[model samples]
Target: MLLQDKVVLITGGSQGIGAGAALGCAEHGAHVAINYHGNSADAEKVVAEVRKKGRRAIAVKGDVADASTATAFVKAAVQEFGKVDVFVSNAGICPFHSFLDMPQETLERTLKVNLHGAYYMTQAAANQMKDQGHGGSIVAISSISALVGGEYQTHYTPTKAGVHSLMQSCAIALGRYGIRCNSVMPGTIATSINKEDLAQPGKREYMEGRIPLGRLGRPDDVAGCVVFLASDLARYVTGASVLVDGGLFVNLQ
Candidate 1:
C-alpha cells in the first residue's frame, strides 16, 4: 500500500525490469499504464496481471526513442488515469560491443533509445505534473555499468552514466515544484536481453562468485526500488542513485 491510488506510467514495460515494476506498483495499489514499443502479447499479459491485482491497468504502444511518441504516451496515460503521479522511464537498449569495433550505427541507436528516450519522457511527465499543481516521482532505470565501465559495454555504459546525470539535473530543476527524480542502477539482472550471455557455461558461477549476494539479480529487485522511490516514503530521497546490484559493484570498488 505504499503507492495507494497513484498513477504510474512505465515505458518498455512489457517485459524484464519494466514489467516487474508495473506489477509491483499495482500490488501497492497504484494504477499502471504500461507502454511497449513491440510485442503486444507481452504488454497484454502484464496488463492482465495488474488487473488481477485489482488495480487499474492499461497497455500503451509507442516507440520511446521518438520524442513525440514518448510525450504522447504520457498524455494518453494522463487522459486515462486523470493524472500521472509517477513516471518510470525504464525503456532502454543495451548492446555490448568492444570499443575497437563498435559501429557508429550501434552507438547512435543506443544513445537515442537509452538517453534521449528517458529525456523526453521525463520532461513531458514533469510538465504534466507541474501543470496539475501536484508533485510526482520520476525513476530512470540506469545500470551499474554507469559507475564501473564494462569491457564490452563502452557504447552502452555511457548512456547509463548520462541517465544518472539527467536524473540529478531533473531533480534539482524540478524540486521547487515538489517533483522527485532518481535513478536505479541495476546489476546483472536476469532479463531476456541478457539471458543468453549470462547462461553461458560457467558464466553464472563466475558472476555469483563476484557478487556478495552470491546470485544474479532479478527484475523485481530493481522494481522494488522503483516503487520505493515512486512512493511518498521517498519524499526526501531525490537526486539519489539507488543501486540494486547486490554488492557486485561495491565489492569491486
Candidate 2:
C-alpha cells in the first residue's frame, strides 16, 4: 500500500473525482477525511465505502469557499486522524453559459468555490503538515481547460489556471518544509456535473472520438494520479502538473 497508515483529507469529496480519490486513498491504506458542502447522505455513503475498505473515515460538512471552513475541516481531520499527510483540493463548480450572457452570480460563485476554496484549504493543510514536522502532499484538481479555452467555460477556465499556478508557487514556498504541491488536470470526466452536457445528442460520441483513448474519463482515472502523487513513489515530485486527459489535448490538430 502506497499510503499505508497515512492521513488524507479531501474537499468536495462527496461525489465525482473527489469521492474517487477518497476511496482510492483508503484502498491504499490511508485514513480519510472528506468535506462536502451539502448532501449529507452522499457524504456518508462515501464514508461508509471508505470504512468498508477497512480504513478509518469521516465526513465533514462545510462549504469550501468559506475560509473558516478550511480551518474547521483541518481541525476535525486532525482531531480524528491525528495528522494530515495528503490534502486534495478538489472542491469546484462550473456553470456553463455563453460568455456574453454569463450571470454575475455564476461567475462570482465559480471563482469563490474553485479558486478561493483551494487556496484556503491548501493553506490550512500546509500549516498542519508543517507543524507535524513530517512533510505532506497537496494535490489540486485543476482542469484541462486551464491550458485551452472553452466556449462556455470562460469564467471557469481562469480559476483552474489559477489553481495550477497556485501549486507552482506553493511548491516553492513550502519546499523547505518538505511539502509537495502539484496539480492534476483532467479532461471531460464523466461526472454528474457534466452528465447533462454529455447526454446531448452526439456530444458524448464526439468527445470520445476526439480523445485518442476513445473513451471519456472516469473519476478513478483522475484519482489514480492523485494516489501516485500522494505516495512516496513521488517523493521527489513537486510543483508539477500531470494531465489525466487521456490524450485529448494532444489529439488537437
Model number with the top lDDT? 2
What are the per-model C-alpha RMSD values against the true structure? 0.8, 0.6
Q: What is the lDDT of candidate 2?
A: 0.96
Alpha carbon lDDT of each predicted model: 0.92, 0.96
Off by over 4 Å in 2: none
| Candidate 2 C-alpha lDDT tens digits along 148-228 | 999999999999999999999999999999999999999999998898889899999999999999899999999999999
State the lDDT of candidate 1 residue by residue for 73-150, as single tens digits.
988898899999999999988776789988999999999999999899999999999998889999999999889978
Total clashing pairs for each candidate: 0, 0
Model 1 stretches with alpha carbons more than 4 Å out: none
- Relative to the unseen true structure, what is the C-alpha lDDT of residue 203 in candidate 2, on a scale of 0 to 100? 96
Per-prediction TM-score, please?
A: 0.98, 0.99
